[model samples]
Target: MYKYDNFDQTIVNERVEQFRGQTQRFLSGELSEEEYRPLRLMNGLYIQRHAPMLRVAIPYGLLSSKQMRMLAQIAREYDKNYAHFSTRQNLQYNWPDLERVPDILADLASVEMHAVQTSGNCIRNTTSDQFAGIAPDEIEDPRPYCEIIRQWSTFHPEFSYLPRKFKIAVSGATHDRAAVRVHDIGLYLVKNGQGETGFEVIVGGGLGRTPYIGPTIRSFLEKKDLLSYLEAILRVYNRYGRRDNIYKARIKILVNELGKEEFTKQVEEEWQHIKNSVLILDQKEIDRVKAYFTEPDYDQNAGDDTGFESALNENSAFTSWASRNLADHKVAGYKAVVVSLKAPGIAPGDATDAQMDFIADIADEYSHGEIVVTHDQNLVLPHVKQADLFTLWNKLSEQGLATPNIGLLTDMICCPGLDFCSLANAGSIPIAKQINEKFDDLDYLHDIGDIKIKMSGCMNACGHHHVGHIGILGVNKKGEEYYQLTLGGSAENDAALGDRLGPAFAKAEVANVIESLIQVYINNRDEDERFLDTYRRIGMEPFKEKVYENN
Candidate 1:
């Protein structure tokens, strides 16, 4: 709920006009594709297999009702009436005319939104927990810091073109819902022994061809030095990170080659020079930014309603949906509801314009006119009264938006594979569909409980496959799609990369492989143990044996 000021509005307006001129020149053949690639990519436009894909940044996945309505309008007028939500909490339109991108940018600017830094080798979106303010376990709200980073990194001349794209995630919660450990820079907001809040900085974490969980370079970083320290890390990477090969260009790769101690030393040296610079945040400036994210007023008298309890007793369907979709909130008598985008038959995270509009309406009517896009390819109404649960469920169910499969197998994180992405080696959407339908039983899914199935069409890991409880990476083996499995991975506080299963399964065998793995879990799991807990306890051998028995 951060609002744009005159300075913010002016900057966006100027950037839109600048990009508009660049686009016109590219279309008029004044610049060749080679010359225009960087320009277009910096503006978040990608030439996909079928059409130009435009990614719009949703900063820290927060959006107002008015902004959500504008997105719905953009999808209807510019895209093919549907948009895809990405793992970075960004939205993508698969079919947008290149000529009208400026118009879309102009429309987005009006809403304090833009596509800036969504693509190319600069800093990408700064992600945080979707449950930032409402989560009971949170240390502090991370959105204000995320906003600070957004402003600092937006077209920062020093980091405009790094060796490769950079990612940063902030987690104010005890549990890491933001996948902080898998980002290039994971900032865990922490309180020291003195009860002074600062950051526990984890550097060089990323997933791709060479997956790495960045080591903690600093156990404690002062809150005032966040941006300065971040700049130091980037400066170190930019100065020494490989530019010789695109494969070795990421900061993770550099950290791996140089060893964590050396990397930490370099960053420390750089930080000493910049720690007291203009980037050093003051209490006044921090408070000013935090003011934009103040909590909404609520009725103190609003407690658990008897009507809601009655509805739960009477309607099994509502009960099931509520159990899966609703999350605990810090505020009593309030719930954070996740709106599933992974309904059966549709591509994961693809929401039609109508669906987006409906969500906006619901957000206004129930969630204080605010919405949140989760990093897990879902939308969230972060503040819903417990009394209005049944009514909200009815509205959501009517629109096919209430799937009740949050944290289940069907609620998987997936990328636009061969369906749209040119770099993809196989189709991920179809595989997700197969798994979704295979695990169609709600009772069975609820019984199994909290299985994260993340699939990527390639090693780019756009789907965040490496961090899923069950990670599936698509590969091409002699023109055939082969799915590789990895198990025991998680993006939580105790984050660890998954180990690869013995061999890759053919596209047809992927679902069967998943089923066999699940059966292994069912056989070995202790009572009430989740998929991840079972995997951790028994390791991957049992599942690997079950999966490759026929191979």
Candidate 2:
């Protein structure tokens, strides 16, 4: 984890005071709502249907145990007793009082976290793989680059106000766990034929009203030119991207209208001027950032533990949990354990104050005093010892944080729909509850295999429904909530938007519809194939027919 320097601390302190004044003025009627709107947004405060929601950025999803404890404190004192971890790997407080938000910001600044750039039409928080440095298949750690971008983009006067909000993601692993293809700017660390590492830069990929898998604007971008090239791309978009319509203002829309070839050409022309400028990253600076993410101390003698093996053999419940929740690590005798927040009746990404405090304690005792927030709304103890697996599992189970459904159907990505978000047409939490109740059987979920069910309350695509193996979208039909279904979408190496199944189902019928789709998969799937693989092989007709046959 990167610690804040004096300059960083000073800036944050100043901003908190600044926002405090702004918030007071707004309340005292010195500043009107219209005038305070952008100011509040710049500080990551949103006026939702019920209250002001405060979104705090967890840079690149990295957190120290100390920071985690602070988050727990904030949830306990400032907002409700729980916080929601979002799809963007950020945390949200849904019930914070408007007058006390500046106090919350001050508390966050003490822990070196902030809410800046979280809501505005400026560059948002840069996200990356939760398994960045520890993943066995990684070419290099992407966190350094992500941090570099965060430093460069935060409060950059040139990009302070774009036509629409922009998102950037980086991935260093062989598989794209960060969903880079769905971002405004996606960078993949790659090796050339000569063994030189660089970036494969992709632009214009986004999902909202329009969905696109961003095209590779540059086949290979040199390491030294990363910032310069990114600046060039942003410059191009800033100059030509639409400003007339909110829906058409995103860079994805611009890329679609201008065509990829023209967009690439313009970015290249813009790059030539800045490529050799001071923006070019040198080895010293790169090494400085890289130093912050160096591996934690490991016991070199750590090897296969007999106790761990024995425990797996003795307990079927632990075995099932391990199979789904644990990921392979680069180092032997260690694993990255995902602490699932999606329990049977809980909302997808929520953690209570007590749970956060306990997780902080566990991270200190087990995972090198660090924690990671996954894009799938789970917490991760990235460097857990294999020898302590059973003990850790038991502790997590006691906290109700040990759900063994990592990639299964119940472990779905869902947004705060009508319950919290005014933009939502339907209630996502209730629907999630219905689905959880309908598919409570762990054995049945295991039998069905990995199915990503992403739900969005509306078309903003906060749930990333477009890339789910099974996508559920909520729609308003004459004051009643109706759910639309899409199948075969994926956010992996082979990224694709899901195809829509015919008509929308009524709210009560959603669970039954999902069951019908699962049954169709069970009937036609080949041995060893996952839900996504079977859906791709069998296509949409079977699932669509099964759902709409009785309609």
lDDT of each: 0.92, 0.93
Candidate 1 per-residue lDDT, tens place, 299-369, comes to 67667467878999999999999999999989888999999998999999989999999999999999999
Model 2 over residues 1-551: C-alpha lDDT tens digits? 78888988998899899999999999999999999998899888999999999999999999999999999999999878999999999999999999999999999999999998898889999999999999999999999999999999988899988999999999999999999999999999999989999999999999888999999999899999999999999999898999999999999999989999999999999999999999999989899889999999986656757788899999999999999999999999999999999999999999999999999999999999999999999989999999988999999999999999999999999999999999999989999999999999999999998899999999999999999999989999999999998998988779999999988889999999999999999999899799899998889888888888876
Q: Model 2 — TM-score against the truth? A: 0.99
Show the lowest summed lDDT stretch of 10 residues, model 1. 298-307
Q: What pairs collide in candidate 1?
A: none
lDDT of 1: 0.92
TM-score of each: 0.99, 0.99
